[model samples]
Target: MLDPKTGLPPRFLRTPDAARFLGISIRTLEKHRTYGTGPTYRKIGGRIVYTLDDLQGWTENGVRRSTSDETPCRVFPARPLTPAEKATL
Candidate 1:
């Protein structure tokens, strides 16, 4: 469907589409959701959906110039954070 504001496809994407857009497997996306480590999503009428902007923003969190770069924001794995990791956040 086209978005009234942008005259393009709607920004919202379902799980599989969102995962493909991010180049990750659907199972990985599900894992991220289960662990609460993925992009921000909306629950609309019992469905979970991600916005294109949110997907891009989440990927941007992992951007780095070098291995030693220290960015405050990061895109973590699709799993629970350890105590030490939680402390850093």
Candidate 2:
């Protein structure tokens, strides 16, 4: 659904506001999205949107008591190599 006032998604935050909520710059957020490390997002009407809950939950993924604490970030697997592909490598 669209917001009657701004015509934007009503419940989710845009990139800028979501970035502010996370205390990060828009570019960083964009990079996260590119690298599959950012908070969960929805592609509504072909536009990106982030819910408050998802943002908060993903943020908690990095929570730790000490600076050295290890928190895993999302990662994607590389494409599988075929028999011929393996020969090239």
Candidate 3:
């Protein structure tokens, strides 16, 4: 089957590439993963990967026609970022 993203066969995308595809920063994507708010991912041979289908599915969760539209979301960390983690930013 043709991959809707690149017109090639479907393939797993690494974090950086997947972040680019989703138009978000790698750090933001990482935060989503940390908070369990990101796309489903696979850990293969110790490397994190995302399938196009999963990314697309996750994207659909955020679809909104207006700012007033409410779609349940949990994209932020439960607690504020620690000083140490903030230093890395």
Pick the lDDT winner. 1
Candidate 2's TM-score reads 0.67
Give the alpha carbon lDDT tens digit for every residue of 1-89 in model 3.
Answer: 56677899658899998999989899888878876778899999999999999999888877789977765653345245679955654
* Sort by TM-score, top down from the best: 1, 3, 2
The ten-residue window of minimal lDDT in model 3 covers 71-80
Q: Model 3 RMSD to the real structure?
A: 7.1
lDDT of 2 by residue, 12-70 (tens): 89899898988888888887887576788999999899998999998777667887765
Q: What is the Cα-based lDDT of residue 51 in candidate 3?
A: 96
Clashing residue pair totals per candidate (backbone < 3 A): 0, 0, 0
Select the stronger candidate by lDDT from 2 and 3.
3
Report the error of model 1 at residue 52, Å: 0.5
> In candidate 1, which residue ranges exceed 4 Å CA deviation?
1-7, 87-89
Of candidates 3 and 1, the better by lDDT: 1
TM-score of 1: 0.82
TM-score leader: 1
TM-score of each: 0.82, 0.67, 0.69
lDDT for model 1, please. Answer: 0.90
Candidate 2 Cα RMSD after full superposition onto the native fold (Å): 8.2
User: CA shift at 16, candidate 2, in angstroms?
Assistant: 0.6
